[model samples]
Target: MAGQWVEVLGGIMEGSGQILRVSTALNCLLGLLLWVQKIRAGAARHA
Candidate 1:
């Protein structure tokens, strides 16, 4: 199997400005997309 890697973007990482790459997995990424879809769907239902 190939190795998995997640790159941290941005040129600088200040004290509280660190963007950790934690959503690189398939399930983790899908969960985020689904969550966003749910939010949009709620707005559409109300509108």
Candidate 2:
């Protein structure tokens, strides 16, 4: 999977920081790295 990337929606609706933290840990354990976007977007929308 060289030069490949996976997209994940990171927002309050998706379990917020908890999901982000767990996903990152799992990626690390699987020897893969990922990039996240729109962190806390839902919270921002509500605000």
TM-score of each: 0.17, 0.55
Model number with the top TM-score: 2
lDDT by residue (1-47, candidate 1, tens digit) is: 23334333333332212222332343265443211112222222344
Candidate 2 per-residue lDDT, tens place, 1-47, comes to: 53356666776467577768876776766655567777677764543
How many angstroms is residue 16 displaced in model 1 relative to the true structure, after the best TM-score fit?
5.8
Clashing pairs in 1: none
Q: Where does candidate 1 stray beyond 4 Å?
A: 1-3, 12-16, 21-47
Give, for candidate 2, the lowest lDDT window spanning 10 residues: 1-10
Clashing residue pairs, candidate 2?
A: none
- For residue 3, give model 2's deviation from the true position in Å: 8.0
